[model samples]
Target: MKINPPRQAQEWSYSSHQESIGEALSSPGIRSNKKTHINCGSSARMAGNVCANVDQIRRQGRWNNTTINDAYLTNLPRELVRSMAGFPTYCRFFYLARAILNPPTSLCKKLFPAIGE
Candidate 1:
């Protein structure tokens, strides 16, 4: 004898406070990219505290007018990408081997132009 109950599909419901997935994953520091900030509690619940991308960091770096060359940061580790706005953790051998080999000399020039010359 079958003792299991039949499964039923439930209707999907959306709350007015719920935000889109893109909005949920977007970082607040990337405002210069023209993304609107969703001011609701659901975004955190939907995306948790760890959502970031390299392209987002590149845009933010350019927006902030940072001296670091974009080429060096393309393959940055996920953690570094997330903290590009703040202080980045320095683990060059493991995380930034490629960038280290090809350093951001432009950044050095911007910081110490006299030495660069």
Candidate 2:
């Protein structure tokens, strides 16, 4: 123990107001990329406690569930989703012939400078 010095104590933090998830979502600053602060009310709900904001450390809450698609997949094109109901037989054959004559592959590739490989 001689080699290791005693732990230095730091000042404690405390807060006394409560906040709701809706209130946080309503705040304009929060988007898919915005950082959020969540306070979990445990078995013992302490009074006057403050919600802490952890910047680098990751945390999630109710707002996470509100989105149908995961963040990574959200950026993908809408066409990636196939038609729920199949197209009419005649139309499908027509498109198939047209695709053979002029393939749509060229239309699918686009380069966005911001998102570089």
**Candidate 2 residue pairs that clash:** 15-48, 15-49, 15-50, 16-48
lDDT comparing candidate 2 with the true structure: 0.29
Q: Model 2 over residues 1-117: C-alpha lDDT tens digits?
A: 012223468432322112233345457554432222233322011211122222111133232322322321133332222232332322222243334564344444443434333
Q: What is the per-residue lDDT of model 1 for residues 9-109, given as tens digits with 9 covering 90 to 100? A: 74333432133323444534333222233322233222222343434544544433242232223333556554674435432323534454754788877
Residue 25 accuracy (lDDT) in model 2: 46
lDDT of 2 at 80: 27
Error of 2 at 104 (Å): 16
Backbone Cα, N, C clashes tallied per candidate:
0, 4
Candidate 1 has a TM-score of: 0.15
